[model samples]
Target: MELHSHRMTALVLLMAAVALAGCRPEAEVAGGALDATDGDPPATRTALDPAAASAPITLEDVMEFDPRYLIGISYPPGMERYPGLAAELRRYAEAARAELMAAVEDLGPSSEDRMRAPYDLALSFDLLMETPEIVAVQAGGSLYTGGAHGIPLVARFVWLPQRDEMLTAASLFQGREGWHEVSAFVRESLHTSLSQRLEADALAPADRFRLLASGGEMIDEGTAPEAGNFAQFEPVPGVDGRLRALRFVFPPYQVGPYSDGVQTVEVPSAVLLPHLSPEYRGLFAAG
Candidate 1:
């Protein structure tokens, strides 16, 4: 216990040394390790002003006293209304916490020279688009544990109020051929984007193909026509209260090297309308 306490002191110093703006812990909000079985918003979250309270719903928790790690998890303001959605988000956050704890346990005695924080987790779920038909959220965040960089995590959720069902990429489409078509469209967009970056127009045909192939392989593999490959998406709503397009999100290392960071491709509704399940076709609009 004596050694453990000393190590915790080190964690504080390490966090202070590397903490970024707005990364400070919330003294009021306790750790979210336990479940809120009653399905109510975490009571510890601060109350918003009356004007803001009536708007979006938010649930956030940050902890810094763990001695071994630090964590932050927040949900969009409107999420509080959907107990089911809130529960799913909680489970996701808990899973991340478990992973961080396990990593901490496996860690050997801390050396005095290690400066980076041992383990840190930050997850923020943002409301992507909400229409009367469906509400979408983009879940993006990172988890770090003694590495040159933190691992990126992301997912998307679509909630149907009328059916009380959560829709995923797998559940949103029909036949396998549809996935193949969608895959092709995404690949074309990504390929063109890569070509522009490599300045293919300036290179000789041979050099263009060679240079494009170097980076395009990862893009192709990452965007295979499987539903899972395109699971993380954000809906782009048209001003007419309809869908304009859907942006597919790819975290680092999925479509390219970590240095490329996160990559996204917007597949216009025209391309996606044909592939969408019949029930969801009305949610989108072309042009």
Candidate 2:
């Protein structure tokens, strides 16, 4: 069976930025990685500055296996300047593409027949928040391979450009002790949000405590703040360009039913600052 082809349509701010800014496509390589002949783009080192207003890093769509399976990936421009980070992104994208393809193949002999029906598997990434210290990107999409409904997933990636590696909750907060504090804050925030929903009749009182308890249980099982329960996060930048609040993301079914959709809770700077390491605290301190 052959997959259908369609002209790519840019989605959301990241894609739109690439389109509007006239980001020229780099020479395509056989594999998913793009070559960086040009020196690292300035955007890689600094936050997106309105004064300069350079185009945001654009991703190229690689591993397109018909309409049934496709993977669109791109990293911070000039990522190639940092060989380690560039290699990591390539590995991640390729592994993700392979995993999705394997799932399609698992559909068996009926796979082709199933493809004839409406089916889609798409994965895309977007730059969520960027600062001199941390760059956060979100990878999310829906997969429908013959189910009652498509499965929606969202994962976050935090990059420390200076360190030339990815950031985890432990590393960011300096130790497990800080992570424990973060987890507690998340639980409190979740309970408060649920309570508000119940009061507003957005959620039935009968389901309120059960759902809240499930969310808390999931949080407790994770060793660190971002282990399993709170895998996605973005730092809200303050007016002064410092970290303001940390946003925790939960996909559908993590906190509530599929109909409830994705859930997010923001922990303000005041709440998170005291728990942060001196290193990270400096990143958010007012100038």
Give the root-mean-square deviation of each candidate in angstroms.
10.4, 10.2
lDDT of 2 by residue, 1-287 (tens): 21222312321332444343336453221111111111111111212233222223334454333645434444444444434434444445555556556666766557555654334444454556555677666655544444344445355667767755665554566555666676777777666766676667767666866766775565444324554455457667788877777777666655554555666777778766766767668657443
| Reference-based lDDT, residue 10, model 1 | 42
> Each candidate: what lDDT?
0.63, 0.52
Clashing pairs in 2: none
| lDDT computed for candidate 2 | 0.52
Best by TM-score, which number?
1
Model 1 agreement with the true structure over 220-275: per-residue lDDT tens digits: 89888897787777777788887888778776666766656677888889888777
Best by lDDT: 1
* Number of clashing residue pairs, candidate 1: 4
Give the CA lDDT, 0 to 100, for residue 232 in model 1: 70
Question: Global CA lDDT of candidate 1, please?
Answer: 0.63
